[model samples]
Target: MVKKKIQVLFEDEHYIAATKPSDLLVHPFKARSQDRRSLLRSLKKQTDLYLFPIHRLDKPVSGVVLFAKSKEATRLMKEQWNSENVSKHYIAMVKGVTETEGVYDFPIKTDKGLQEAKTSFKTLTSNDEYSLVDIEIFTGRQHQIRKHFSRRMHNLVGDTKYGHSSINNIFRKDYKFYRIFLHSYQLRFIHPFTKEEVIISSPVTEDCIHIANDLFQFDLTNIGNEAKEN
Candidate 1:
């Protein structure tokens, strides 16, 4: 396996959090014997220790992701996650204007077949061609946010598979970007073993900022409707 860079966000005796780069799989694949790079293997090799995944971010989604260093920590983390004790937040640039805050409660099915689920969203920023959306998922389904928005009138900027042709054509169709516009910015949950509240966050990725700047000439200001417009 060839070596690659790993971005560690927060690390401790019990667990580790990382800003996962786009297009990297959390774990290795049995389907492909030739693909040698995987996040799990990279961390283990670098730390000489095992880590457990408490939750998964999609291959295209980039930013803060958590991993447990010990079995007990892993178990407890998973418990907190399953109990709806965690608050996960993501920001994305989707096509079209979202005038007010809204929720998307639609059923999402699996790609292999049909075991669909539901999710919701709230718009934080509005622009003529794009909006900065703050998203939340009630149910953990594969590509829930991506697929849901893709099926809508507007599509997330860099999404290829579920995105509409006209919207996606504004960007590249064949290439999977270095990162998608979606970013896992905030995570809040009770400490798995400590029984205390913990909140972790990552600043919105630069790629999104650049895209917004190129199109809207925006900084963080216009994300809120009340905030000054760019």
Candidate 2:
């Protein structure tokens, strides 16, 4: 298999933002017996810099991931993340038609026990089969979006763990989509050093655009283009 190069969205002395592909681990996991590829190692090899992950995307999810160039930068960025100052936005294609706009104010169980988690979503378009929605997460809980949507019976398309296999098979058979239909579309936070507000966004993947067009007749490409212009 050919290696997919990580797409860098923004980079500077203090930080780097890149698009992570699905199935790529942000850091090494000790539990997995087999040696697995990691995004941190790949980025370090590619840039020859000591990069520190300030935030993470789940292994099966793709899109905007942030890293700090130095430990000090990492410390500063983590402050923003821990304080809930960072704004995370995502675009997802799910199994059922959701409400036009609403918040999933639910708590999720973690190693630390139950924690308050909330996600706000607005349906961009939908058909009888599926809904395309924009999601904004207020708390960074493990698998929060997936769990919230799954609990509502609107699991994200291609989510193997929380989604129905029959629904996943439809997309796999029809559109050949195997990865989870969740992308980290945008990230907004204050630059720790400069005190400047920074917003970084990644365009929807081509596969996602094609699937949305074929399934719901929604043009995600146009939406991505418009976002670039703004």
RMSD of each: 5.3, 2.1
lDDT of 2 by residue, 62-130 (tens): 888999999999998887784556888899998878999999997998778999999999999999989
On TM-score, the leading prediction is 2
How does each model score on TM-score? Answer: 0.81, 0.93
Error at 177, model 2, angstroms: 1.3
lDDT of each: 0.70, 0.85
Candidate 1 segments whose C-alpha is farther than 4 A from its true place: 1-5, 111-118, 173-178, 220-230
Q: Highest lDDT: which candidate?
A: 2
TM-score, candidate 2, is 0.93
Residue-level lDDT tens digits of model 1 in 1-230: 76456766667678777767776777765576566766777777787888888777777787678889888898878766745787677888888886466666766678566545555677766767888778866666678778778777657777777665666665554332444688887676777667666666666666666666666666743332221101
lDDT of 1 at 57: 79
Full-model lDDT, candidate 2: 0.85
